[model samples]
Target: MGTWQLVLVGLVMLLGLLGVLVPGVPGPLLVWAGILWWSMSEKTTPAWGVLIGATALLLVNHVVKWLLPARRLKGVGVTRQTVLWAGASAIVGFFVVPLIGAVLGFIAGIYGAERVRLGGHGEAWAATRTIMRAVGTSVLVELVACLLVLGAWMGAVIHG
Candidate 1:
């Protein structure tokens, strides 16, 4: 792929990463499509390998997401803003403390948002738990899967 094409692919992947946070967005599919586009353009062994791995990984991600409990944010009263905060925090955490930090940051972000909204630690914690049980696992799984795919693509691009 040319430099511009690579940059465009990277931009698409980044958008897909952000899409994972927003409800109703086909984040995984977008990420996979970006990989496919890059692989087709590059036509190298590593590029093809990355595409295959990303496809399998994202397919598993979809299955796992389906198996998880459906999101019930309305029942739990978790707002979209809270989810956005959690996602933004997760991104920062991923870079700040690596893999584990993402989880910690997500949980903290939820707690912080709930604390601000509910005005008490106890209530916020309860709401946080409810929110997590309702939707956190699904989002976390999808985010991690996309991150893995993005990381693999970056590695291939760098090494190829």
Candidate 2:
């Protein structure tokens, strides 16, 4: 039913929003799902080329982001234990506190881990800053992509 399609679109939207909060679960991926579903329905099939191009853009963004400083993640000068503890703490923070806590969790994780493992608050903080900057860059890139996806969806709707 047409309404069911809309429901999937809404699910896509929810996933996209949550994806913003949590890494790994991607927002654009969900948006693409909505796009695909809507297109399959007798909806104005937004050009496949546009969809493919947008996906290509996301791929490029991913590659470029990889080139950037790895933030809050494992890497040189960062031990596996450090990364693992950081993640574990963040997960706990999510349930223990809530929205803001989850965010603070990462920062605290690094600080706590390094302070214990590396025994240097300064070094730990430097890593934290680097990670935050990378995270910021990632969010900006995703925001732009999300805007494009929305525009494409809207175009399909209006033109159809």
Candidate 3:
């Protein structure tokens, strides 16, 4: 793929990552499609490998998400702003502290957002816990899977 095509692929993947936080956005599908596009255009061994890995990973993500409890954010009163904060924090955390940072950042982001919204440490923590139980795991799983795919694509692009 040309540089511009690669950049576009990256943008698609970025949108996919954002889609994970947005309801009914088909995040993983976008990520997978970006990989498919790149692989089809590049036709290189590494591109093919990344595409296969992304496919398998995203398939597993779907299965894992299905096994998890259904999202109850509406009942729990979790807001989209909170999710967006958590997602942005996760991205920063991924770069700041590598793989584990994403989870830590997500939790912290929830807590911080809740703290600001509820205006009490105890209430915020409680809300954070409730929100996590309601929908955090599902979002986290999808985000991590997408991030892994993005990382793999980046590796292939840089080293292929």
The digit string of per-residue lDDT tens for model 2 on 1-160 reads: 3677666775785677568557556776776776666665653335565467667776776676666545435553677776677788778888888766667787788778878865687877787776667667877777677667767666666665
Model 1 weakest 10-residue run by lDDT: 66-75
- Model 3 C-alpha lDDT per residue in residues 73-153, reported as the tens digit of each score: 666677889888988887788789865787788889989998888899998899888867756688898999999999999
Best by lDDT: 1
* Residue 154 lDDT in candidate 2: 65
Question: Which candidate number has the best TM-score?
Answer: 2
Clashing pairs in 1: none
**Would you list the C-alpha lDDT of every candidate in the order shown?**
0.87, 0.68, 0.85
Model 2: lDDT equals: 0.68
On a 0 to 100 scale, what is the lDDT of residue 37 in model 1? Answer: 98
What TM-score does candidate 3 reach?
0.63
Q: How far off is residue 107 in model 3, in Å?
A: 18
RMSD values for the candidates in order, in angstroms, are: 8.3, 3.5, 8.9
- Where is the poorest 10-residue window by lDDT in model 2? 42-51
For each candidate in turn, the TM-score is: 0.63, 0.73, 0.63
After superposition, which runs of candidate 2 have C-alpha atoms over 4 Å from their true positions?
1-11, 14-18, 23-25, 43-45, 65-76
